[model samples]
Target: MSSKKSDSEKITIVIVGGGIGGLALLNALSTSIDPEKHTVVLVDARPSHMHLISALRLVVSDADDLLNKAVHPYGNHTFRNKFAGNGSFVHGSVTSVKFGDDGKGGELILDNGEIVAYDVLVLATGSSWPRPLGFPTESRSAIEEHIMARRAEFSAAKDILLVGGGSLGLELAGELKDIFPSKPVSIIHRERLLLNDTYPDKYRIAVQKAVEDRGVTVLLGDAITASNSSDVSTSQVPEGGFVTEQGKKLNPDLVVPTWGNRPNTSYLPSDLLSSTGHVKILPTFQLPAYPNVFAFGDIIDWKEQKGAAKAAFFHTPKVAKNVMVYLDLSERASTCDLMASRRSAKYTGCMEMIMITNGKSRGLGYFNILWGIIVGSWLITLLKAKTLMIGRIPSQTGFTPK
Candidate 1:
């Protein structure tokens, strides 16, 4: 990174949402993009990056330091030093983008009434999960308060019911059981299997068995009626608890819904969005109408399931390469040449891969490659069950894990 280039002479690359994808792209650009030619700016609504991968563990466990470990502040000296003279982190929420007629470059209008100009833009404003998994606040203290409140709720509950049997529901059940051994935790999945049909039945069965082995009840093939399910924000069961479609009434002290993650694309234009609210992008991760604008992470309409690992490991490098190529060709290349470069660098898709942890010592998962290899307890514990990859955040952000 160099301080020699004047601001006017450099290309400003603005990225929205400093979640896994945005941070990964920032790290990539920090290492490879020319500092003298390009100035990078990452804007996030939150004060720090909440490692949502380990969120369940943080809230469920009694450990006080886990919350501190789960949050990685963008303004921290370590992160600031990483981007020293080249890039900067902005704290704001984007309300809308004012793109030119050609959709080449645009100014982003922030909710706080600030405008950020960009020569190239990247949207990675990830999805929002249910409570305990999602942070609705922006300030660090408010976020901590939210976590502490959820922790208190879990502590006071006589029994907990996890309302969807996705990865989040399973992981939350596991964490609760691991922390409070006798705390009656149950998972009620609408589907017959633990997960969706993305993986084979064997893997789903293995997950359910692992969860059941931990003494957590696994109720499948039944769903709570809409009348019993509360607002989307809380998704709590009513006073008498919820009655499943199969006529089983569960009266748990706490009900947490783990399904229904909406992409943070409300601020984006409808033209750039799919019917499902995800940004429509070409294989190169660039918007079809706005070539200079790119998107990835859970916010993009990629066929594959969204995960932090996918964004950090796969999408980051591809998007970074394409952005660099676009920058390099902006000065001299013809439209055909630019399109050719983008077409040559592309991400076709990724296979279905998921790992579910059951308590700290047990779990099950499968990778679709090699025809869906089922990973057992030991590998799951070693990989994710114990720490939930909390250390990866610091490493990815150029800091040593404590």
Candidate 2:
């Protein structure tokens, strides 16, 4: 618990989670820190980093090779070769983190009972949603089976009800309409506006109009409640259309929940968490209780919409630089000022940019910082829906495309 590593020893930086923020941090560290001084470890429960946005289309289309396309193996030869002696990837879920005395880093307790000690810790575990929307399985075959089963359900159902009018709900509704236009697709969102409140009114209206134009029924400002019982499972398909809080009833053959993401920070210390269970980080992206313990992405309590692109672009570099400062301090302990280094590595928030697509063809994009510019379907399709930025992940992580 002394939280000290000798200068001769390589500083171990354990990054818990291999999602966008974690992997980006690994890539950034690979360039910033010298291998002789530091060794980085990328840890995750999954064997591959999933392109979740790509999986949305796959769920609707039932693409046979989507598993291959959407998931990129962390054990890729090119990615491994780039890190070489500098870093390595570990496949295991972190069950708990045992912090060292003060804010000087600690040990990661893996679910498999293995312990990983770290000089610096980066928690980028991100957030989780209901399955089929998000792949919960680590194995490729398991994910394939999950998707196929969902596809079968979609195929058989005549009426589908998607709860929540957020981007995911709208996108899934649109995809269902595109694939099975004959089926009745409806979205029941508690909010009158589409998307979240973070977005401007014009942007939300544009998305609502676009989704409605796709022939999908939009039910706004009504919360879905079970008519008889409050014990309705979040993932359960309703027996009959559930009533709203105001006594309106809706019946759908299949109900897919598409809102709210819980942060994957159950293993984090309670003091570091917000009331909502997300990790609380300073503007420098470091936890107050543990400055050497940096966190970002959806897991952090940043008041903004969470997205993979945003995590990769904004959070990763700031974390990598701060970690490097710690490493450098460990090396030149006599000279470097830790306080100055932490202050210099401040992370001012990023601009609000979002692209929500309705399946393959149409969607809306908004860059609020850029004078509230709105992008149309063609731009959205070209930028995201067509590929879901799958290629970009591999490129950023230094993995050759399969």
Candidate 3:
């Protein structure tokens, strides 16, 4: 593909996927650089940006008050009021990217046959989870309905079985128990420990204890396989419970699948992707062969645990600086080894930090790399449960926080 003729002298930066990383990068570039020199365009398939972490909490809760707060439209919120007229939002899905011969610039072909050219490209499409847990939907009402349906299922069920012992599954179990204390809730994890072996032993043990203390049954070290049982009706609450590889049977009225997130990179070239389907980025958050092309958040091949906080607080700032350096070099024609000099220092895999809450009250938090200290329910509630940071989304999108 060849570069298109430009009407203006300004360089164009096209960022795909308006997730946390993309929004942060847009914010950083908009605030740091002069609008006259650069034009920014954000492309996303969804009409609104969904605060997924907060959505998780909302799905399990009985209150419907926070549904509108969890989703924000990009046109009216992120790129509408901000950007100072230098940025535009495209509501479409990119089918593929065609790079220029120089590898510094490219044109993105959207599914709707629209082609957008860019001097620089950023991939922050992130990942997708299963429906009723995490999935892409443009309709806010659809998501609210799904949550309400799931809530009804949870309430009507006599026993609830949550598949996967990861943080999400555990949190769901805790929330279910807290909301419906009389119902029997159990978490079936394949691993022997909660949250797998990635975290420290102390934190795992503490989390297991905290979850079990909430009256949630913790079943570990068993691989669960779902099978249709003749004894259960097709329209039953659970459909059917899973049986362990060890021949253990668990029958619950409701079964919620809550793990595994597939990276969203179908539009990217195969050569630019890792074996696991994630975009391959260097330490500077740039594509290995194409420095002008950057990626971060859950879509990049970073080893750290993926979360909104990690992307917003850590990865986006580094990517912003790298993009700035690239733009500076292009403008000045200087021969500075910007990537070499500004590569992000290797991130030492430190102690894992996470706050898992049952509801608005009980929870568990783990912090401190040197000392694995487990925080009580009150601290977790204070940190996340009370708000789930839903109140911060408006300000995060450049609007006044309500």
RMSD of each: 2.5, 3.7, 4.3
Tens digits of per-residue lDDT, candidate 1, 1-402, equal: 855779778888998988888888887777777666778788898878878777887887556477777787776443343356667778899999987655457899988899999989999999977887778556989888888888888988998888889888888888888778898998988997988887789888888888888888989999888777663248455777777899998888788888757898999878888899999998999888887899999999988888888988889889999887777667554456547564547898877777788767788878988767998889989998787787787866655535
Q: Model 3 Cα displacement at 378 (Å)?
A: 2.6
Superposed model 3: Cα runs more than 4 Å off: 1-9, 62-64, 80-82, 226-240, 334-351, 399-402
**Index of the highest-lDDT prediction:** 1
lDDT of each: 0.81, 0.75, 0.74
Per-model TM-score on C-alpha atoms:
0.93, 0.91, 0.88
Residue pairs in clash, model 3 = none
Cα displacement (angstroms), candidate 1, residue 238, comes to 2.0
lDDT of each residue in 15-125, candidate 2, tens digit only: 888877777777777666665556678888877777667777788775536666667777644234335655667778888888887556588998888888888888888
Candidate 1 vs 3: which has more TM-score: 1
Lowest summed lDDT window (length 10), candidate 2: 226-235
Candidate no. 2 TM-score: 0.91
Q: Which stretches of candidate 1 lie over 4 Å from their true place?
A: 1-3, 76-82, 231-236, 337-339, 399-402
The clash numbers for all candidates, in the given order, read 0, 2, 0
Tens-digit lDDT string for candidate 3 (1-402): 735334366788888988777787788777777566778889987766777766666676656466677767776457533366677888778889888765468899987788899988988888876544554455656666777876677777888777678878877776677678888888877787988666778878888888888888988887555453322223243334556777887877676776657788998889988898998878778787776788888888877777776778788887888787778777776526654466443333334578887767877887756666778888988888777877777766765434
Q: Which stretches of candidate 2 lie over 4 Å from their true place?
A: 1-8, 76-82, 226-234, 334-343
